[model samples]
Target chain A: EPEVTQTPSHQVTQMGQEVILRCVPISNHLYFYWYRQILGQKVEFLVSFYNNEISEKSEIFDDQFSVERPDGSNFTLKIRSTKLEDSAMYFCASSRVQSENEKLFFGSGTQLSVL
Target chain B: LAKTTQPISMDSYEGQEVNITCSHNNIATNDYITWYQQFPSQGPRFIIQGYKTKVTNEVASLFIPADRKSSTLSLPRVSLSDTAVYYCLVGDPMNTGFQKLVFGTGTRLLVSP
Candidate 1:
């Protein structure tokens, strides 16, 4: 089974620095999403993308965050001037299409650690 | 937003049937009940999803009442490998868009031998 894969499984960056997390969603998936889990907190959605454009974003996706699909397979999340609270397990998910029966398949996740 | 309520933790043994219940009092008509499983340091995986009555798959079963206010995820013959956190989410997963999903503190199921 094809799975969503993320790069830099572990990322450590200094506070105020910039970081870009990357993901290659499963082939044939048309929708992509990004979410974060702050340690013990529940997984929170950040943004969703489709047709190379952002569909929806959450409050957590403020000025510092941006998502891009610069290529056919790679989806990336860029955070400018990172903050300590931004440290969390960032997940990349993809779905076949938009439907209630369509399940979002996730990648192993990239653990972002801010110093 | 539909807020779902579920247990914090549960304990089960091998060969036992495990059922975790979730209540979403404000669920909308278009929302579908879905369940996911997660191990530590990993992303959540889809288990099952249902709109009403009962829906069963090889891995698990999802039962939603007529009111659509609550749903149950049933795992049969759970074992050690079944130890993980289970999350119940209600939402509309149509192509129109994806919402910023807020997964509550999930129910931790510990299945022992």
Candidate 2:
């Protein structure tokens, strides 16, 4: 089964530094998304990308965050200035279709540790 | 997006059947109910989904009652390895352009010997 793949399984960064997490969605997937799960918290939506543009974003996706489909296969999330609260598990997901019952393929996730 | 409510945790013995129910009282007609299971340090995996009635798969079964206000995930003859967090999400499929899946604090299932 094809899957979404994320890089840098774990990352450690100091506060105020920029960090980027990368993902390679399934080759045939048309919609991509980024979500974060804070330790002991629920997974929250960050942003959704389609057609090389941001289709939607959550309030948690503020000025500090941005997403890009740098290439046909690579999607990235960049945080300009990280804070201690930014520590969490960032997940990348993709869905082949936009159907109500469609299931998302998720990566193992990139654990971002902002110190 | 509809809000979902589930129990914080559940405990079951090995070899027993377990049922976890999620309530989405304000579900829309176009919304579908889907469940995902997550182990520690990993991403959520699709378990089962149902629009209405009962849908069964190899891993689990999804039961959506009439009214569409709630759904149940049934795990039969579970084992210790089946311990994980289960999340229920409700969203419309037509809004595919930016369909965001909002996850609530999932129900943590602890299966022990």
Best by DockQ: 2
Please give the distance, in angstroms, between residue A17's alpha carbon in candidate 2 and its true position after superposition: 1.0
- TM-scores of all predicted structures: 0.95, 0.95
Compose the digit string of candidate 2's lDDT tens values, residues B1-113. 88999999999999999999999999999888989999999999999888999999999999998999999999999999999999998888676346587788899999999
Which pairs clash in model 1? A98-B95
Evaluating just chain A, the predictions reach TM-scores of 0.98, 0.97
Candidate 1, residues A1-77, lDDT tens digits: the string is: 78999999999999999999999999899989999999999999999998889889988999999999998999999
Worst 10 residues of 1 chain B by lDDT: B93-102
iRMS per model, in Å, is 1.5, 1.4
Positional deviation of B74 in candidate 2, in angstroms? 0.4
Model 2's DockQ score: 0.78
Q: What DockQ does candidate 1 have relative to the true complex? A: 0.77
In model 2, which regions exceed 4 Å deviation? Answer: none
Residue-by-residue lDDT tens digits, candidate 2, A2-71: 8889999999999999999999999999999999999999898899888888888988999999999887
